[model samples]
Target: MTGNARLDLAIFDAVDIDTVGAFYAGLTGWDIVRKDGERFGLRTPEGQEIEFQRAPDHVPPRWPGQEFPQQFHLDLETDDPQAQVERAIRLGATRLADGPAWITMADPAGHPFDLCQADGVGPVMRLFAVTVDAPDASELARFYADLTGMRLVHDHPEGALITDGERNLMFQRVDDYNPPRWPDPAYPQQAHLDLVVDDLVTAQARALELGARRLSAGGERYRVFTDPADHPFCLVW
Candidate 1:
Protein backbone atom coordinates (compact mmCIF):
# COMPACT_ATOMS: atom_id res chain seq x y z
CA MET A 1 0.00 0.00 0.00
CA THR A 2 1.15 3.53 -0.70
CA GLY A 3 0.03 5.81 2.14
CA ASN A 4 -3.60 5.17 2.95
CA ALA A 5 -5.75 2.06 2.67
CA ARG A 6 -7.11 1.46 -0.81
CA LEU A 7 -10.80 1.43 0.16
CA ASP A 8 -13.26 2.09 2.94
CA LEU A 9 -16.50 0.33 3.95
CA ALA A 10 -19.48 1.40 6.00
CA ILE A 11 -19.90 -1.86 7.89
CA PHE A 12 -22.71 -3.36 9.98
CA ASP A 13 -22.07 -6.15 12.47
CA ALA A 14 -24.18 -9.26 12.92
CA VAL A 15 -24.49 -12.03 15.47
CA ASP A 16 -24.31 -14.60 12.70
CA ILE A 17 -21.95 -13.61 9.90
CA ASP A 18 -23.23 -16.30 7.56
CA THR A 19 -26.83 -15.23 7.85
CA VAL A 20 -25.93 -11.58 7.31
CA GLY A 21 -23.50 -12.32 4.49
CA ALA A 22 -26.05 -14.45 2.72
CA PHE A 23 -28.51 -11.57 2.69
CA TYR A 24 -26.01 -9.19 1.06
CA ALA A 25 -24.47 -11.81 -1.21
CA GLY A 26 -27.90 -12.53 -2.64
CA LEU A 27 -28.56 -8.83 -3.10
CA THR A 28 -25.32 -7.85 -4.88
CA GLY A 29 -24.34 -11.19 -6.35
CA TRP A 30 -21.07 -10.88 -4.47
CA ASP A 31 -19.38 -14.05 -3.37
CA ILE A 32 -17.27 -14.73 -0.33
CA VAL A 33 -13.59 -14.09 -0.93
CA ARG A 34 -12.40 -15.32 2.44
CA LYS A 35 -14.12 -16.80 5.43
CA ASP A 36 -12.30 -17.62 8.68
CA GLY A 37 -15.15 -18.47 10.97
CA GLU A 38 -15.40 -15.07 12.62
CA ARG A 39 -14.61 -12.78 9.67
CA PHE A 40 -15.88 -12.74 6.08
CA GLY A 41 -15.10 -10.84 2.91
CA LEU A 42 -17.66 -10.28 0.14
CA ARG A 43 -16.36 -9.23 -3.23
CA THR A 44 -18.35 -7.22 -5.75
CA PRO A 45 -18.36 -7.92 -9.47
CA GLU A 46 -15.59 -5.38 -10.00
CA GLY A 47 -13.41 -7.02 -7.31
CA GLN A 48 -14.30 -4.61 -4.54
CA GLU A 49 -14.92 -6.31 -1.23
CA ILE A 50 -16.86 -5.73 2.01
CA GLU A 51 -15.94 -7.41 5.26
CA PHE A 52 -18.24 -8.58 8.05
CA GLN A 53 -16.94 -9.89 11.36
CA ARG A 54 -18.73 -12.31 13.65
CA ALA A 55 -19.24 -10.57 16.95
CA PRO A 56 -19.31 -12.37 20.27
CA ASP A 57 -21.79 -10.14 22.07
CA HIS A 58 -23.48 -8.98 18.91
CA VAL A 59 -26.78 -7.35 19.63
CA PRO A 60 -29.20 -6.91 16.78
CA PRO A 61 -30.15 -3.27 16.85
CA ARG A 62 -33.81 -2.52 17.43
CA TRP A 63 -34.47 0.32 14.97
CA PRO A 64 -36.74 2.35 17.22
CA GLY A 65 -34.80 0.86 20.13
CA GLN A 66 -33.90 3.61 22.56
CA GLU A 67 -30.54 2.13 23.57
CA PHE A 68 -29.46 1.15 20.08
CA PRO A 69 -29.72 4.02 17.61
CA GLN A 70 -28.76 3.75 13.99
CA GLN A 71 -25.07 4.63 14.14
CA PHE A 72 -23.27 3.51 10.99
CA HIS A 73 -25.17 2.38 7.88
CA LEU A 74 -24.42 1.21 4.37
CA ASP A 75 -25.64 2.93 1.22
CA LEU A 76 -26.20 0.60 -1.75
CA GLU A 77 -26.50 1.78 -5.32
CA THR A 78 -29.75 0.56 -6.79
CA ASP A 79 -31.72 1.90 -9.73
CA ASP A 80 -35.04 1.60 -7.96
CA PRO A 81 -35.12 1.76 -4.17
CA GLN A 82 -38.82 0.90 -4.04
CA ALA A 83 -38.20 -2.31 -5.93
CA GLN A 84 -35.14 -3.06 -3.84
CA VAL A 85 -37.06 -2.41 -0.64
CA GLU A 86 -39.83 -4.74 -1.75
CA ARG A 87 -37.33 -7.48 -2.40
CA ALA A 88 -35.34 -6.77 0.76
CA ILE A 89 -38.54 -6.88 2.80
CA ARG A 90 -38.96 -10.45 1.75
CA LEU A 91 -35.30 -11.13 2.59
CA GLY A 92 -35.54 -9.67 6.14
CA ALA A 93 -34.60 -6.02 5.56
CA THR A 94 -37.01 -3.30 6.62
CA ARG A 95 -37.68 0.14 5.22
CA LEU A 96 -36.76 2.94 7.59
CA ALA A 97 -37.60 5.72 5.15
CA ASP A 98 -37.96 6.00 1.41
CA GLY A 99 -37.90 8.92 -0.98
CA PRO A 100 -37.58 9.31 -4.73
CA ALA A 101 -33.78 9.53 -4.75
CA TRP A 102 -32.94 7.49 -1.67
CA ILE A 103 -34.27 4.92 0.77
CA THR A 104 -33.06 4.26 4.31
CA MET A 105 -33.50 0.72 5.49
CA ALA A 106 -32.28 -1.87 8.00
CA ASP A 107 -30.78 -5.31 7.53
CA PRO A 108 -31.98 -8.48 9.22
CA ALA A 109 -29.34 -7.87 11.90
CA GLY A 110 -30.92 -4.51 12.65
CA HIS A 111 -28.07 -2.53 11.16
CA PRO A 112 -29.16 0.48 9.14
CA PHE A 113 -28.31 1.07 5.47
CA ASP A 114 -29.53 2.97 2.44
CA LEU A 115 -29.99 2.39 -1.26
CA CYS A 116 -29.49 5.08 -3.86
CA GLN A 117 -28.47 5.61 -7.45
CA ALA A 118 -24.82 5.84 -8.39
CA ASP A 119 -23.70 9.19 -9.87
CA GLY A 120 -20.11 8.53 -10.79
CA VAL A 121 -18.09 7.11 -13.66
CA GLY A 122 -15.72 4.27 -14.44
CA PRO A 123 -13.59 2.94 -11.55
CA VAL A 124 -14.19 6.12 -9.59
CA MET A 125 -17.58 5.08 -8.24
CA ARG A 126 -19.11 6.55 -5.09
CA LEU A 127 -21.03 4.13 -2.93
CA PHE A 128 -22.51 5.08 0.44
CA ALA A 129 -21.04 7.90 2.50
CA VAL A 130 -19.96 6.82 6.02
CA THR A 131 -21.83 8.38 8.92
CA VAL A 132 -19.88 9.28 12.10
CA ASP A 133 -22.33 9.52 14.98
CA ALA A 134 -21.59 12.03 17.73
CA PRO A 135 -23.25 14.04 20.45
CA ASP A 136 -21.38 17.31 19.95
CA ALA A 137 -21.36 17.63 16.19
CA SER A 138 -19.04 20.60 15.86
CA GLU A 139 -16.49 19.38 18.38
CA LEU A 140 -16.21 15.88 16.95
CA ALA A 141 -15.85 17.18 13.38
CA ARG A 142 -13.08 19.54 14.42
CA PHE A 143 -11.30 16.84 16.38
CA TYR A 144 -11.43 14.33 13.54
CA ALA A 145 -10.53 16.88 10.87
CA ASP A 146 -7.56 18.17 12.82
CA LEU A 147 -6.40 14.64 13.56
CA THR A 148 -6.76 13.39 10.00
CA GLY A 149 -5.79 16.55 8.07
CA MET A 150 -9.19 16.56 6.46
CA ARG A 151 -11.53 19.46 5.72
CA LEU A 152 -15.07 20.18 6.78
CA VAL A 153 -16.81 19.54 3.50
CA HIS A 154 -20.36 20.41 4.51
CA ASP A 155 -23.00 20.57 7.24
CA HIS A 156 -26.37 18.98 7.85
CA PRO A 157 -29.21 19.00 10.34
CA GLU A 158 -27.92 16.22 12.59
CA GLY A 159 -24.23 17.05 12.25
CA ALA A 160 -21.40 18.03 9.92
CA LEU A 161 -19.74 16.13 7.10
CA ILE A 162 -16.09 15.81 6.23
CA THR A 163 -13.78 14.15 3.75
CA ASP A 164 -10.13 13.17 3.64
CA GLY A 165 -8.97 12.47 0.13
CA GLU A 166 -11.20 9.54 -0.94
CA ARG A 167 -12.66 9.00 2.50
CA ASN A 168 -16.08 10.57 3.05
CA LEU A 169 -17.65 10.54 6.53
CA MET A 170 -20.88 12.07 7.81
CA PHE A 171 -21.34 13.17 11.41
CA GLN A 172 -24.81 12.66 12.83
CA ARG A 173 -25.89 14.06 16.16
CA VAL A 174 -27.61 11.95 18.79
CA ASP A 175 -29.03 12.81 22.18
CA ASP A 176 -27.52 11.29 25.35
CA TYR A 177 -24.91 9.27 23.56
CA ASN A 178 -24.00 6.88 26.41
CA PRO A 179 -21.35 4.57 25.03
CA PRO A 180 -21.52 0.77 24.82
CA ARG A 181 -23.16 -1.46 27.40
CA TRP A 182 -19.63 -2.60 28.13
CA PRO A 183 -19.02 -5.39 30.70
CA ASP A 184 -22.60 -5.21 31.94
CA PRO A 185 -24.99 -5.44 28.98
CA ALA A 186 -22.99 -8.19 27.22
CA TYR A 187 -23.99 -6.41 24.03
CA PRO A 188 -20.60 -5.02 23.20
CA GLN A 189 -20.60 -3.75 19.65
CA GLN A 190 -19.00 -6.49 17.62
CA ALA A 191 -18.17 -4.09 14.78
CA HIS A 192 -15.65 -1.28 14.74
CA LEU A 193 -14.02 1.21 12.37
CA ASP A 194 -10.35 1.16 11.45
CA LEU A 195 -9.06 4.72 11.20
CA VAL A 196 -5.60 5.45 9.80
CA VAL A 197 -3.80 7.94 11.92
CA ASP A 198 -0.60 9.89 11.35
CA ASP A 199 0.85 8.80 14.68
CA LEU A 200 -1.02 6.11 16.53
CA VAL A 201 0.12 7.23 19.98
CA THR A 202 -0.58 10.90 19.46
CA ALA A 203 -3.90 10.16 17.85
CA GLN A 204 -4.85 7.91 20.71
CA ALA A 205 -4.00 10.64 23.17
CA ARG A 206 -6.05 13.19 21.30
CA ALA A 207 -8.98 10.82 21.09
CA LEU A 208 -8.82 10.15 24.80
CA GLU A 209 -8.83 13.88 25.48
CA LEU A 210 -12.02 14.10 23.48
CA GLY A 211 -13.82 11.64 25.74
CA ALA A 212 -12.95 8.52 23.74
CA ARG A 213 -12.71 5.53 26.05
CA ARG A 214 -9.68 3.36 25.69
CA LEU A 215 -10.69 -0.23 25.14
CA SER A 216 -7.34 -1.95 25.01
CA ALA A 217 -3.82 -0.66 25.44
CA GLY A 218 -0.48 -2.31 24.63
CA GLY A 219 1.90 -4.09 22.28
CA GLU A 220 -0.33 -3.88 19.25
CA ARG A 221 0.37 -1.17 16.71
CA TYR A 222 -3.23 -0.05 16.92
CA ARG A 223 -5.36 1.19 19.80
CA VAL A 224 -9.10 0.66 20.24
CA PHE A 225 -11.42 3.20 21.75
CA THR A 226 -15.15 3.65 22.19
CA ASP A 227 -16.90 6.73 20.89
CA PRO A 228 -19.57 8.68 22.67
CA ALA A 229 -22.09 6.33 21.09
CA ASP A 230 -20.30 3.24 22.44
CA HIS A 231 -19.15 2.20 18.94
CA PRO A 232 -15.49 1.25 18.72
CA PHE A 233 -12.92 2.88 16.43
CA CYS A 234 -9.30 1.99 15.91
CA LEU A 235 -6.19 4.16 15.68
CA VAL A 236 -4.16 2.31 13.12
CA TRP A 237 -0.50 2.89 12.26
Candidate 2:
Protein backbone atom coordinates (compact mmCIF):
# COMPACT_ATOMS: atom_id res chain seq x y z
CA MET A 1 0.00 0.00 0.00
CA THR A 2 1.11 3.52 -0.66
CA GLY A 3 0.95 6.55 1.57
CA ASN A 4 -1.94 8.07 -0.35
CA ALA A 5 -5.31 6.51 0.41
CA ARG A 6 -8.91 7.54 -0.07
CA LEU A 7 -11.46 6.69 2.58
CA ASP A 8 -14.54 4.49 2.91
CA LEU A 9 -15.67 4.65 6.52
CA ALA A 10 -16.90 1.58 8.44
CA ILE A 11 -19.09 2.47 11.41
CA PHE A 12 -19.95 0.05 14.25
CA ASP A 13 -23.28 -0.67 15.89
CA ALA A 14 -26.20 -3.08 16.42
CA VAL A 15 -29.15 -1.80 14.45
CA ASP A 16 -31.63 -2.71 11.75
CA ILE A 17 -29.74 -4.16 8.79
CA ASP A 18 -32.09 -2.93 6.11
CA THR A 19 -32.24 0.45 7.74
CA VAL A 20 -28.52 0.94 7.31
CA GLY A 21 -28.63 -0.42 3.79
CA ALA A 22 -31.16 2.23 2.94
CA PHE A 23 -29.05 4.94 4.55
CA TYR A 24 -25.92 4.32 2.51
CA ALA A 25 -27.53 2.99 -0.63
CA GLY A 26 -29.60 6.15 -0.74
CA LEU A 27 -26.71 8.49 0.01
CA THR A 28 -24.04 6.99 -2.19
CA GLY A 29 -24.69 5.43 -5.58
CA TRP A 30 -23.33 2.07 -4.33
CA ASP A 31 -25.51 -0.77 -5.57
CA ILE A 32 -26.38 -3.94 -3.70
CA VAL A 33 -23.93 -6.74 -4.27
CA ARG A 34 -24.90 -9.69 -2.08
CA LYS A 35 -27.71 -10.58 0.29
CA ASP A 36 -28.35 -13.03 3.08
CA GLY A 37 -30.71 -13.14 6.02
CA GLU A 38 -28.77 -10.34 7.77
CA ARG A 39 -25.49 -9.25 6.19
CA PHE A 40 -24.94 -7.52 2.83
CA GLY A 41 -22.78 -5.01 0.92
CA LEU A 42 -23.35 -1.97 -1.43
CA ARG A 43 -21.27 -2.19 -4.56
CA THR A 44 -19.79 0.69 -6.53
CA PRO A 45 -18.20 0.56 -9.96
CA GLU A 46 -15.21 -0.83 -8.08
CA GLY A 47 -15.11 -3.22 -5.12
CA GLN A 48 -14.98 -1.57 -1.70
CA GLU A 49 -16.67 -2.99 1.39
CA ILE A 50 -18.75 -1.90 4.39
CA GLU A 51 -21.07 -3.93 6.68
CA PHE A 52 -23.40 -3.90 9.71
CA GLN A 53 -23.79 -6.10 12.78
CA ARG A 54 -26.80 -7.23 14.77
CA ALA A 55 -25.73 -7.17 18.39
CA PRO A 56 -27.45 -8.96 21.24
CA ASP A 57 -30.11 -6.31 21.74
CA HIS A 58 -27.78 -3.44 22.51
CA VAL A 59 -28.51 -0.15 24.21
CA PRO A 60 -27.84 3.23 22.66
CA PRO A 61 -25.06 5.42 24.08
CA ARG A 62 -25.64 8.44 26.29
CA TRP A 63 -22.64 10.69 26.83
CA PRO A 64 -22.22 13.31 29.58
CA GLY A 65 -23.86 10.67 31.71
CA GLN A 66 -26.87 11.60 29.61
CA GLU A 67 -25.50 12.45 26.14
CA PHE A 68 -22.22 10.89 25.12
CA PRO A 69 -19.81 12.50 22.75
CA GLN A 70 -20.01 11.07 19.27
CA GLN A 71 -17.56 8.17 19.52
CA PHE A 72 -16.57 8.26 15.85
CA HIS A 73 -17.60 9.82 12.58
CA LEU A 74 -17.18 9.10 8.87
CA ASP A 75 -15.51 11.95 6.95
CA LEU A 76 -16.58 12.34 3.35
CA GLU A 77 -15.02 14.60 0.70
CA THR A 78 -16.82 16.34 -2.08
CA ASP A 79 -16.62 19.42 -4.24
CA ASP A 80 -19.86 20.72 -2.82
CA PRO A 81 -20.67 19.79 0.76
CA GLN A 82 -23.95 21.68 0.83
CA ALA A 83 -25.21 19.99 -2.30
CA GLN A 84 -24.27 16.63 -0.92
CA VAL A 85 -26.02 17.37 2.34
CA GLU A 86 -29.20 18.26 0.48
CA ARG A 87 -28.96 15.04 -1.47
CA ALA A 88 -28.38 13.01 1.67
CA ILE A 89 -31.41 14.49 3.35
CA ARG A 90 -33.55 13.87 0.32
CA LEU A 91 -32.30 10.30 0.15
CA GLY A 92 -33.28 9.57 3.77
CA ALA A 93 -30.23 10.70 5.74
CA THR A 94 -31.57 12.37 8.84
CA ARG A 95 -29.89 15.64 9.58
CA LEU A 96 -28.16 15.55 12.94
CA ALA A 97 -26.17 18.75 12.53
CA ASP A 98 -25.81 21.47 9.97
CA GLY A 99 -22.97 23.82 10.64
CA PRO A 100 -20.59 25.78 8.50
CA ALA A 101 -17.66 23.63 9.52
CA TRP A 102 -19.47 20.43 8.71
CA ILE A 103 -22.82 18.75 8.25
CA THR A 104 -23.57 15.67 10.34
CA MET A 105 -26.18 13.12 9.32
CA ALA A 106 -27.14 9.57 10.14
CA ASP A 107 -27.70 6.36 8.25
CA PRO A 108 -30.83 4.28 8.72
CA ALA A 109 -29.06 2.44 11.58
CA GLY A 110 -28.11 5.56 13.56
CA HIS A 111 -24.38 6.08 12.97
CA PRO A 112 -22.90 9.57 12.67
CA PHE A 113 -21.25 10.65 9.44
CA ASP A 114 -19.65 13.99 8.60
CA LEU A 115 -19.64 15.87 5.36
CA CYS A 116 -16.99 18.32 6.35
CA GLN A 117 -14.96 20.54 4.12
CA ALA A 118 -11.75 18.76 3.26
CA ASP A 119 -8.89 19.59 5.56
CA GLY A 120 -6.74 19.79 2.53
CA VAL A 121 -5.56 16.34 1.46
CA GLY A 122 -4.28 14.11 4.20
CA PRO A 123 -1.18 11.99 3.89
CA VAL A 124 -3.52 9.13 2.93
CA MET A 125 -6.44 10.57 0.93
CA ARG A 126 -5.12 10.74 -2.63
CA LEU A 127 -5.06 6.98 -3.01
CA PHE A 128 -7.67 4.32 -2.19
CA ALA A 129 -8.41 2.59 1.10
CA VAL A 130 -11.36 1.22 3.03
CA THR A 131 -11.55 2.37 6.64
CA VAL A 132 -12.79 -0.37 8.93
CA ASP A 133 -14.16 -0.09 12.44
CA ALA A 134 -13.80 -3.16 14.64
CA PRO A 135 -13.40 -4.33 18.22
CA ASP A 136 -10.68 -6.90 17.54
CA ALA A 137 -7.62 -5.36 15.92
CA SER A 138 -5.82 -8.45 14.74
CA GLU A 139 -8.76 -10.22 13.19
CA LEU A 140 -9.88 -7.26 11.06
CA ALA A 141 -6.34 -6.50 9.96
CA ARG A 142 -5.97 -9.98 8.60
CA PHE A 143 -9.43 -9.79 7.13
CA TYR A 144 -8.52 -6.79 4.99
CA ALA A 145 -5.57 -8.58 3.44
CA ASP A 146 -7.68 -11.59 2.58
CA LEU A 147 -10.58 -9.48 1.38
CA THR A 148 -8.49 -7.24 -0.84
CA GLY A 149 -6.21 -9.99 -2.12
CA MET A 150 -3.29 -8.22 -0.54
CA ARG A 151 -1.07 -8.55 2.51
CA LEU A 152 -0.87 -6.87 5.89
CA VAL A 153 1.35 -3.84 6.08
CA HIS A 154 1.56 -2.10 9.47
CA ASP A 155 0.62 -3.65 12.81
CA HIS A 156 -1.55 -1.75 15.26
CA PRO A 157 -2.54 -4.12 18.02
CA GLU A 158 -4.70 -1.34 19.36
CA GLY A 159 -6.85 -1.58 16.21
CA ALA A 160 -7.15 -3.23 12.80
CA LEU A 161 -4.92 -1.76 10.07
CA ILE A 162 -4.35 -3.08 6.56
CA THR A 163 -3.36 -2.16 3.05
CA ASP A 164 -4.12 -3.27 -0.44
CA GLY A 165 -1.51 -3.27 -3.18
CA GLU A 166 -1.89 0.48 -3.72
CA ARG A 167 -3.91 1.88 -0.82
CA ASN A 168 -4.41 1.43 2.92
CA LEU A 169 -6.79 2.08 5.84
CA MET A 170 -6.64 2.02 9.60
CA PHE A 171 -8.97 -0.31 11.47
CA GLN A 172 -9.74 2.09 14.27
CA ARG A 173 -10.54 0.92 17.80
CA VAL A 174 -12.74 2.92 20.14
CA ASP A 175 -13.26 1.79 23.71
CA ASP A 176 -16.62 3.53 23.69
CA TYR A 177 -17.31 2.97 20.02
CA ASN A 178 -21.03 3.00 20.60
CA PRO A 179 -22.67 3.71 17.29
CA PRO A 180 -24.91 6.79 17.11
CA ARG A 181 -28.69 6.70 17.28
CA TRP A 182 -30.87 6.94 14.21
CA PRO A 183 -34.57 7.85 13.76
CA ASP A 184 -34.66 9.41 17.20
CA PRO A 185 -36.21 12.84 17.25
CA ALA A 186 -33.55 13.90 19.77
CA TYR A 187 -30.52 12.62 17.86
CA PRO A 188 -30.51 11.07 14.45
CA GLN A 189 -27.75 9.09 12.71
CA GLN A 190 -25.01 11.13 11.05
CA ALA A 191 -23.35 9.51 8.04
CA HIS A 192 -22.22 6.30 6.36
CA LEU A 193 -19.14 4.98 4.55
CA ASP A 194 -19.25 3.78 0.96
CA LEU A 195 -17.25 1.13 -0.92
CA VAL A 196 -16.66 -0.06 -4.48
CA VAL A 197 -16.39 -3.51 -6.08
CA ASP A 198 -15.64 -5.21 -9.35
CA ASP A 199 -18.70 -7.40 -9.27
CA LEU A 200 -21.55 -6.27 -7.03
CA VAL A 201 -23.39 -9.60 -7.01
CA THR A 202 -20.43 -11.82 -6.19
CA ALA A 203 -18.93 -9.41 -3.70
CA GLN A 204 -22.22 -8.91 -1.87
CA ALA A 205 -22.69 -12.69 -1.57
CA ARG A 206 -19.18 -13.16 -0.27
CA ALA A 207 -19.72 -10.51 2.35
CA LEU A 208 -22.97 -12.07 3.56
CA GLU A 209 -21.31 -15.47 4.04
CA LEU A 210 -18.57 -13.72 6.00
CA GLY A 211 -21.12 -12.61 8.64
CA ALA A 212 -22.54 -9.44 7.09
CA ARG A 213 -26.19 -8.56 7.77
CA ARG A 214 -28.04 -8.11 4.49
CA LEU A 215 -30.52 -5.27 3.97
CA SER A 216 -33.64 -4.98 1.88
CA ALA A 217 -31.80 -2.56 -0.37
CA GLY A 218 -31.46 -4.40 -3.68
CA GLY A 219 -29.93 -3.13 -6.89
CA GLU A 220 -30.06 -4.59 -10.35
CA ARG A 221 -26.28 -5.02 -10.35
CA TYR A 222 -25.21 -4.47 -6.72
CA ARG A 223 -26.09 -5.13 -3.05
CA VAL A 224 -25.65 -3.79 0.50
CA PHE A 225 -25.18 -5.29 3.99
CA THR A 226 -23.90 -4.72 7.50
CA ASP A 227 -21.00 -6.51 9.11
CA PRO A 228 -21.04 -8.64 12.23
CA ALA A 229 -20.04 -5.70 14.43
CA ASP A 230 -22.95 -3.63 13.12
CA HIS A 231 -20.81 -1.10 11.28
CA PRO A 232 -22.47 0.20 8.10
CA PHE A 233 -20.23 -0.01 5.08
CA CYS A 234 -20.82 -1.03 1.44
CA LEU A 235 -19.37 -2.56 -1.74
CA VAL A 236 -19.86 -1.17 -5.27
CA TRP A 237 -18.92 -2.00 -8.89
Which model scores highest in lDDT? 1
RMSD of each predicted structure: 4.1, 10.2
Across 81-187, the per-residue lDDT of candidate 2 in tens digits comes to 67778888776777776778767676555556766666454322122344444566566565545555555677775765565544456566556454433334344
Q: For candidate 2, what is the lDDT? A: 0.54
Model 1 poorest 10 in a row by lDDT:
1-10
lDDT of 1 by residue, 61-82 (tens): 6554547655566657765566
Query: In model 2, which range of ten residues has the least summed lDDT?
Result: 1-10
lDDT computed for candidate 1:
0.65
The TM-score values for the models, in the order shown, are 0.76, 0.46
